[model samples]
Target: MELFEHLSLGFGVAFTPINLLYCLVGCILGTLIGVLPGIGPVATIAMLLPATYALPPVSALIMLAGIYYGAQYGGSTTAILVNLPGESSSVVTCIDGYQMARKGRAGPALAAAGLGSFFAGCVGTLILAAFAPPLTELAFKFGPAEYFALMTLGLIGAVVLASGSLLKAIAMIVMGLLLGLVGTDVNSGVARFSFDIPELTDGIGFVVIAMGVFGYGEIISNLAQPEHEREVFTAGVSGLFPTKQDFKDMTPAVLRGTFLGSALGILPGGGALLAAFAAYALEKKMKMKPGEVRFGQGNIRGVAAPESANNAGSQTSFIPLLTLGIPPNAVMALMVGAMTIHNIQPGPQVMTSNPELFWGLIASMWIGNAMLVILNLPLIGIWIKLLTVPYRYLFPAIVLFCAIGVYSTNNNTWDVWMVGLFGIIGYSFVKLGCEPAPLLLGFILGPMMEENLRRALLLSRGDWSVFVTRPLSAGLLAAAVLMIIIVMLPAVKNKREEAFVEE
Candidate 1:
């Protein structure tokens, strides 16, 4: 009954004219970026971050949340139609989604992605609403030791779950940590590696690194590929709904994905991407039979599972950010900044003191999901047409947008130049077969990990065993160690190599 009352209040807040409008705008903008290959929600949100300053806190957050999931919806469109995934979470979809397109099943594949996403999103939101308060309460008990251990577990999980060589993943993580440390030391008043640059004192803007590597970096990598190898949208989409078999096959996949994503999303680091990849892995392991189609060969479950998983994962990532004042990913870190900008401390107190923002954000997700379904379903034809735009014309526009976005962050040209440099570095990572996503996770977590580690040490009076003495922290560390060992085993190593080769 209390839950009902809270939900009713949330509805009242979300139904306001301004909030609804913001939600609509976010969905529209998110879809636009999602349809374009190489552009991601992270970059788009970073570009739009400055614009949100004028908005009411609830309205701004509602809109930003809409953009996040809306991009997820839009990414599937390109993945299905053109074999291009604008977001990392959508990469798994490209496998079967493209194959389905080749077999003239693009319409069904797309419909499955949309419907599965909507269903799972609703379920995930409900789970979030139900679980968040208790989690917030639990978060109150965490000390510096717990946080440090949690981050360590998260980093390990990110590397293990990322799709690539373990060595390369570790290297990328170390590089990210190094990059994160380039600014002034927070504890001491001394500069670490700023090279005497004024901008370095404030640290590298997340926008610069994200856009350079994810946005411009992707553009350069795509341009380097032979034109003949680039997949084009040639399939004529005829239907707007999935068939009976597609519906049947996708139902279980969606449910499984929702459960998996919701659980994994609460974990720190690469939650959405890991959930998507893990869902695909689970579906492949299940070996569900579709009519005359193999797992990676135009299977509807492939599209449904990952799509559902990513959306669910994206929604549940809010758990840590809202409850504990801890950001599990770069996007969540940005959300923390948003909250701080509004003078709201993101912790257990938020739920009690700012019920409007908490429940309101939850309610807005349902509204935004509904908006995305209505907006995206009818616009499938429009998104498909976006594939017709030539890469030559598209790449320059993307680069220009990235530059403008980076510059707008701090009104500094230095950040823009840094973006360009990172773009080259991003391109290099691609050429070397390194996964940049883990680097992002590492960079986001490094500072938090350092702060927590130092605080834990201080509390324990320099005791090195504090991490191992705490039961919960020790358990998480053990699990992380076990995960590392399992991944390094010869059989598992070979299997991982084979999976990447297939991708």
Candidate 2:
């Protein structure tokens, strides 16, 4: 079969010695960072983006993929141990996961998380393998009009699905789109919002925004918290995994989460955070075994559902990036940057032109998932020790490294200073309860939207009807409008916000 042949090629590439080593390194590093509260994969990957320039394309992607999913694996540990989420997706896990730890069921809770994640990751990957080809085919049919319409849908999805105030999310996205317009116009060769700064002529660097907003923003937020590091749990955490009955209770939750997460992960703005929260909420709404643990108090279903959903979501989030060259989340946006660094375009042609890199990256995810399971369980002790380190010492070193990384991106101190200014903006977003992920999605998509819209108009000789005349493009635009309307309904808006709440 075509799929089998592709897998053979993928494994051959992913199994190379160098690729395997990087995979191991990435998994280990991701686990380490993911165990530390307040640091997520976006910042970590952004920190390491420069380092990947030295790596072969396959190896670079293999390692970054490991970090992305490995964080999912390591995140549950902190959620269970310290009542903190290392990744945003793990936030829902903390509700019941920490309760399990408190009730002396940490071992079982962790086992459920690990096992559920591994299973769901495999299913998500399988779904990706089966569906990506068709999606890629569909993508090839798109024109400039269709692309603009699809991007409209994506931006709307980001606005509707983001977890804070809808107004704030919209504002953030509009800001990102506006900021995306700060560079020189392609057709006119005139600067729009460059403010006469040389660096602004090329637009703001995605790396700087990512590092400043995700990295430095997180540092400031963490520093603002009081110096109160919780002691790591040692007892009830070292032994006693799930029993037969526990497995019986967990199997259904894992299945539900995998299906739910796989479907949601393909949608714009529906990444691990949304999937996890949705799955956890759905589990609570469904009927449970009469004698089982209650919803927020050491429920294995709680651990399994969110953990599985997050991993599934993390894997399936790649569909948009790989198929359409559109990034569905901040992490996928980072992956787009990675692909561009290697001079590989992140679209349908990638599969036809570079099958090895594409398939190998897919295969590497399964390998990374396996590696995460092996690395996370045995290295739990080391990860726990990392959490014990004080923020006072940890944050300064982080800020210093981030500064160095941003400056190293273009070898310009101006970029570093710009990152500092963005850091303030990032912190302001946090204090105002605004989510930055949608802003990131908007920033990444804005330029692409403008280019396509311009192209569509040019092709149509300035005819505005071109967007509505094409059936496919019109359908997509209609869906975008429908989505916005659905989300704006009072009941749906309430439920949407409520579903994304951690607890």
Candidate 3:
């Protein structure tokens, strides 16, 4: 009865004419964003943050949420058609999705991604709705010590699960933490690393870093590639439906990926990027059929699992943000900024104080997922045509768009300049074969961790034992330590390193 009433309220809020229109617009924009090369949702959301200033808080969030998942749906399209991933999460899809395209099975691959994503998204939202209350209840018991411990767990999980060398991942995390400390010291009012720059007083904008590393960085990388490499796979796509064998393979894979992605999404620092890689790795590890296609060779399960997992992970990543006031990844960090712009603190109180916003956001996801399925299937022809645009023509517009977006944030060219500087750094990382996602996660979470650590020590009268003495905090620390040890094991380390290597 309670669940039904809550859902009814949600539908009432989500079904408003204005909200529905914005949701539709967001879906279309997100699909366009995803179909293009060298653009991802993190950069897109950050670029569009200013546009939301005119929208109602609920409607603004609905649009952003739609954009997030809609990008996931469309990302697979680019991956399948061009072997280019519009989002990091779509990177895995290229392994088999592009191969399927080359074989004229592009239709099945796109259908699998769209359908699997819809199912996973539905299930993910259901889990978020059902599980958030209990998690909120659990969160109410959190003190400073527990919060610190929780962040530690999150950082550790990121390091353990991050792609590439473990040492490099840890170094990136440390670098992010340092970057996060470059503003005013909330405790002492002393600027830590501003070096006397006025804008540094407010700290660097999360959007600035995201645009630099993901947006401009991607632009630079794409320019470095040969023109031939940028050409779209000009393969014919027929048969807009999956065959019976595809169903047999994709059903189990989608279900498994959904469950895996949902569970990972609840973990701090775990988001769609991680979920997609982990799901593909899991599928590869599972016993292959006697004569079916292998992974990295057009296996349908490879397309379905990562698509489902990434969508599930994308939705569940909202769990920590909505319930605990924690952002799991760069995109969620942007969401925190969005919530604050509306004078809303993103925490447990959101449910009780703004029940309509909370439930409406939940309901809007279901609507958005359905909207994506409808919009994507019929419009497949249009999306593929977009790939025909050449990279030389596309990159300039993207660079110009990013410049305008960054300048709009503060009406200053400084952020634009910063984007260029970070673009170089991002390119360095790319050249060095390093992953940047974990660094962004660390940058977002670091300050929160420091604040909690100080508060916990203050309460403990500077005693460090409080983290270990409190039962919940102690348990969290224990789990983090166990994770570190497991990650350090030679066999596990080698396997994780191999698992993330793109084919």
Ranking by lDDT: 2, 3, 1
* Collision count of model 1: 0
> Of the candidates numbered 1 and 3, which has the greater TM-score value?
3
For candidate 1, give the lDDT. Answer: 0.83
The alpha-carbon deviation from the true structure for residue 144 of candidate 3, after best TM-score superposition, in angstroms, is 1.5
For candidate 3, what is the lDDT?
0.87
Q: Tens digit of lDDT per residue, candidate 2, span 113-205?
A: 988999999999988888888999999999999999999999998888888788998998999899889999988999989999998999899
**For residues 72-111, what per-residue lDDT tens digits would candidate 3 score against the true structure?**
7777898888898888889999999999988889899999
When summed lDDT is taken over every stretch of 10 residues in candidate 2, the lowest stretch is 228-237
Model 2, stretches more than 4 Å misplaced? Answer: 229-236
- CA RMSD (A), model 2: 1.4
TM-score, candidate number 3: 0.96
- Tens digit of per-residue lDDT, candidate 1, span 1-503: 87888888899999999999999999999888878876677766766676787789999999888888777888888888878787888999999998988888888898889888898889888988888888887877788988887778878877776776788889988988888888888788788888888889878777677777877788899898788877776555787788887788889999999889988887776788878888998998996563537877888889999999988988888888888777776677767767776788877888899899889999999999999999888888888887788889988887887787667767898988999999999999989988887787777778888988999999999998999989878887898889889988999888767655536
Record all residue pairs in model 3 with backbone atoms less than 3 Å apart, i.e. clashing.
none
Off by over 4 Å in 3: 285-291
